[model samples]
Target: MERELSRTLPHEPIRWLKEAGFGRVRLPREKGGDGASLPQLFELLAELAEADSNLPQALRAHFAFVEDRLNAPDGPERDRWFERFLDGELVGSGWTEIGGVKLGQVNTRVTPQADGWSLNGEKFYSTGSLFADWIDVYAERSDSGGPVIALVNVAQPGVERDDDWDGFGQRTTGSAPRVLLMRGSSRRTSMTLPSASATKLRSISMCCWRRWRGSAARCCETSARA
Candidate 1:
């Protein structure tokens, strides 16, 4: 898998984004994807992480948000975002906050506008937002009511970005904090499970199993005939 990814990734972001098939790993088959399930998706993530942790972390974030966008119940909006994501035109997700809160808690607020919406808040641990064209910024429930998942186009005038990521590990992830200065159209929604930690555990276990089986296979393949 590492060899495959190294051959495919090319050490270039734009090329890898289009070639890796990472952005849509869990997308339904009907939507121009392989339609991987949770376990199978984990397998792929493990393989990719074994090659490069940052690679898989970014991939996991991308796909998790992709799944969220696809399932968000906003049919036209979902299709719009998903198509852009698949085409590598728009990268997605804003997974963290500057205040160190856990995922799913939002300090951001989305206000409805005459056209779409306005977003205001700071996000931390945004793994892919540095190069992302859009972000799924979560916010507190609006005073008007309904859900609070807002898909904000970061290229807009009010979006602000700060790539302040200098972590010891996963340096290549490009994780950072971004502040949304304006609101946008939003809806109540659930987030798909992140595959980072799970992918790590699965990679370790699979490596052990492969080593054990490899030893056995070697024994069988190089045995002396009686």
Candidate 2:
């Protein structure tokens, strides 16, 4: 138990979370999820982090996507995504980009293609992406120049991920990896999700709570094991 944090990713634990439907904890019970509230989700995350901080970190993006979908207007389109979550598919983050003025403001971009929009960008510190079925990429449309979230399938040839972290601690928080999406077709979420909604703000708060609580939880766990 005292060994250095495994250089290997916690594939088995992540698999357990998926099979147990932890990823869909935010969905309604009728929608085949636990239907947990945001506060409840944050509570569970703190507990999960207590056991293994990396677990909550790995799931950050997945939960965020769940919340996003929960906020979307209900329809068959939304139901399909709910079913995907019920089926244990996970979403990963692709929000952060390196360099400056790669575009007007955002580095990532989605350009129109004959088939659909192609997401082209390089993201750093792409936490949890390696374990994801899809990536929730933040990109701007080239034509309209508006921001959108591009839900990109991981199986496509255009997505690339590698663990390139050289930091001093937490070798495998499922973080600090790089993801490159090169002209990958995506399912776009328009910017209509209200940013000011007090309910939706819980998602952002949950992210903050995970970061602040995860380390202390891990420390306590290590001490208990000692």
The number of the candidate with the highest TM-score is 2
In the range 162-213, model 2's lDDT, one tens digit per residue, is: 7776766555656664654555564443233234452355456566665757
What does candidate 1 score on TM? 0.63
Candidate 2 is scored at a TM of 0.81
Worst 10 residues of 1 by lDDT: 186-195
Candidate 1: tens digits of C-alpha lDDT, residues 43-135: 665665545656655554456555545556658766766677567654545535567666546666656556655566777666666556667
Residue 198, candidate 1: how far off, in angstroms? 19
TM-score for each of the candidates:
0.63, 0.81
- Looking at candidate 2, the ten consecutive residues that score lowest on lDDT are 189-198
